[model samples]
Structure formats: C-alpha cells, structure tokens
Target: MFESAGDVIKPKGDVNAPSGLQSVLDVEEAAEPVLPHFFPDEQNDSIPRLSRDTFLDILDGKYNEHYDNKLIIDCRFEYEYDGGHVDGAINYNDKELLASHLFNSPLEGRTLLLFHCEYSVHRAPLMARHIRAQDRTVNAECYPRLNYPEVYILEGGYSGFFAEHRQRCYPQAYVEMDAAEHVRTYLRFW
Candidate 1:
C-alpha cells in the first residue's frame, strides 16, 4: 500500500541503474574516478583533492629538502601577480593565447612543480597536465592556495592571506586596532 513513494522499491537482482538518476540513494554508488591513488583529498568541483598537511610539507621545503630543485609556478594573470603572490612563484599567465605560451618553460625532470592560481581555476591543473604530457615521468603537483601541510583555497584570493594566517603569514601588517581607537582614527582623519 506504499502509494506515495515512487522509487522506494528495488527490483530483485537488478544492478544496472542509470547513473543520472543515482541521486535517489537507493541507486548503487558509482566507482570513484580513476585518478592516481595519492590524489589529494581536499578537492571539490572547484578545487583539486589534495592532502592539506602534505601540501604544506611540500611548500615548507620538505619535498625540496628530500629531492633536488623544485618549481612553484603562479598561474594567475599579470595584473593579479602585480598585486601579490607566494614569495618566489614564477608568473606564467599569457592571457587568452594559452597555446602560444603553453610549455614554454623548461621544467626539470628531477624537480617538483607546484602550481597555484587565485583559486586554482583553469590555470593550475592546465599547467599540470601540460607538464605531465611533455614528459610522462616528470614529478609534478598543483596547489591553488598555500596553507601548508594542509593545502587550502585562498578563500578571498590574496586577501585571504590575512584571513588564514593573519599572525603568521603577515606578522607585521595585521595590526590590531582597538575599537575606540579605530573609530577615532577614522573620524579624525576624515
């Protein structure tokens, strides 16, 4: 007498359910994507899945210390880089001419490459794939933002730098202004 439910019943021994309709929960879960086993766990539709802590370790020189020279590439536009970026990142934004500048940089096989963008958007992974396709055996990875050991998305791009590690990432600049002092300073200046 279950007249209200449309999909509460499972046909006996039936296993070939449509993937499009799998959201009903009763449908079988699809096998995971065929990415590498060590793929980062922090990924989403927007961000790639990467281990947060492992990302930090790499940024902090753990991988470089162990391996030879490594490369960290910033894939944001020129204007974005002009604003700010990770201390030593190399700028690789060539605008709409993606084909012209693609693979122009000679990445070292012995080096570990880390790719970052404002939010890792089209740039980070794009470069990663290009790098891999060039030499299938090259060692490479990507990070949209840098929070270390735990790679994180820059919630507000570079502005997020202060939000994530206000005290640590920017020790000298994130000065705390007292509420009264803040109001007085603003009012007095105006």
Candidate 2:
C-alpha cells in the first residue's frame, strides 16, 4: 500500500509482485536509529494515534473528555501550518524549538506530545533525542528514567499522515536525515 503522499516507505521494490522488484535505493541509513524493540509483538497502547478524523473528532468534542488540553506539536514548516494542521496542534518549527519546548514544559502531568513533520522519519526522532536530553539537564519532577511523559512520533510522518487519509495542499518535499558518518563523508569530500 502506498503511504498517503505516494512516498514509497517499504523496501522500495514492489512487495506485491511475487518476484520482488529491485531498484537502486539511496536513502541514507542512520546509525542505531531504530532502537531494539523491547516488546517484540506486543503493542504499546500508550502511544496515541492522531488520524485526521480522530483529530477532528477530538476538536469537535467527541473525545474531549479523553483528549482536551493534551499537547500536539506539529514539526512541519511554517507554511504547512498556515495552510492547515490538526485543530489544536501547536507548531514547533525545528529541532531547536522542540528541545526548548521540552525543557520548558511541565512533564509531571498527563499530557501527550505528538510530533509530526512531512512523513519523513528523522526529524521527529532527532527532536525526541533533544527532548530526552532535556530531561537529563533539568531536575525533572518526573524521574528521567522512571516516569518521563510519553512522546509519540506520528506514524508516516507528515506526508504519510496527510496522504493516507487527507487532501494535501502543497507538493510534498522529501527531506532525508543522514547518519553522522555520512555527513562526515560529505564534509571530507567537499
């Protein structure tokens, strides 16, 4: 199945073809980006899913009792937010803002932080790293290890989210995050 914006997320080749399609895949692989899965098959129900309809429903009060005042952070570009975003999500422009927000916001209570940006996987995780680092820097009321609040990466990123179920207004741009080593190679070559 195609991700919302027709960005192929699977192994690039056609999975449906009994004979796997092959192509030159060039996305830079990050180091240890996908952490070891502690729960193999088990689902973590704690991570919230914010689909278009569900987001709208929450905004319309259908799920207000369960969702009101929870934080939803959209990491998309400014134009994207101005064009449209889920009803209540506040925009955190880049990784820096993400870190600052995490450092400043109270982490003691029940709040959900949903991070989304154009369906690319790297930005959210980078932002997560910054957020986690903030926990260590501050004398967190919530223990950094024991009970840090939950932060979620929106499935499919922004393109996946929008393309999967909603109409996208802007042409989707592909932003790839390279591993540190690859970045070094660029610097060396140039």
Candidate 3:
C-alpha cells in the first residue's frame, strides 16, 4: 500500500487496498469532527490507529525499523495545549491551514505523524481526515500514492495516554480543556 524510504514513506504508484483508497470527502462533507467518538464510525478513511502503549514504543524507538522519525500534532485549543501536552508536540489546531502547509511543505524524511486532542475523538481524527483528503487532491492524478502516507491518530488521545505516561510528558502534567482556571487564558487563545 506504501513505499518506504529511510525517512519518507511514499505509496507505491500502484496499491491494492481492500476498500480501494479514496479521499475522505468521498464519504462526508467538509465538516470538522464534532462530539466525542464514543463508538467507531463507519467512515473507513484509511487513517491508521496507534495505541498509547505503541505510542510509547515509538517514542522509545521500537518503530525505528519502519519510521525514521515521528511528529506529534496536538490539535487542541492553544490554551489547552500550553497548559500541558505531549512532549515535543507542536500545537496546530487549524485543519485547513495545516493541510495546506503539509501538502506544500518541503519537509524531508519519512516520519509518522501522530495527531490528537483531549480525547482521540473529534478534532484529532478530523484533522487527520482533512490532511488525507487534501493529500488525495494534491496527488489526484497519481491516485493512491501520497507525499506522506504514515498518518495516525493516538487512540484515547492525550488524556488517556498522559494518565499512564505522565513521566514521559514535558512537565509531567495533564490539563483538561474545560478547566475553570484558564478562563482568562482562553480569551487570549481565542
């Protein structure tokens, strides 16, 4: 389904996926994910799933054999992210902007892109879906092949992951998005 270089994983010009890869827009409109993902949805958009334990493994270098690097994209409000986030995670909440940048970016290397918000529910999945859609459009003529094919969503999101892996977080703390104390901070973020 994909072609792998030392740093960049490119899909083979030809791929044989069961569902026959297509853009996310094929199933849903250009709507961002809302509400929590209490149950899995039917949109099998091909975005891979990554477990928290496996996330830790990747951080510990277990996936070095497959991915040369990884990027943790925290898609929460700026305040929520600033309060606490995965170590080394970059805060990028705008899906449209992110997609535009990723498609046009000159970033090199094969890297696993891990996306998440408070829960691995809405924002995270939607952003991943958007990126895939934009990627499809960018390489429409080429079909299934993509510039960066290794996109994943961290299961249970940061809340679940941080609960068990606090030691791995930057400041070893987790902050809820609705915390009362950040009311003033939220305004600035907005």
Best by lDDT: 3
TM agreement with the true structure for every prediction: 0.44, 0.49, 0.71
lDDT, residue 144, candidate 2: 32
Evaluation by lDDT, superior candidate among 2 and 3: 3
RMSD of 3: 14.0
Give stretches of model 2 more than 4 Å off. Answer: 1-68, 105-108, 139-148, 167-190
Leading candidate by TM-score = 3
In model 3, state the lDDT of residue 23: 56
In TM-score terms, candidate 3 sits at 0.71
Candidate 3 ranges beyond 4 A from true positions: 1-45, 183-190
Compose the digit string of candidate 3's lDDT tens values, residues 126-181.
89988888878887755655666777888889899888888878767777877889
- For each candidate, what is the lDDT? 0.44, 0.51, 0.75
When summed lDDT is taken over every stretch of 10 residues in candidate 2, the lowest stretch is: 31-40
Each prediction's total of clashing residue pairs, residues at least 3 apart in sequence or on different chains, is 11, 7, 5
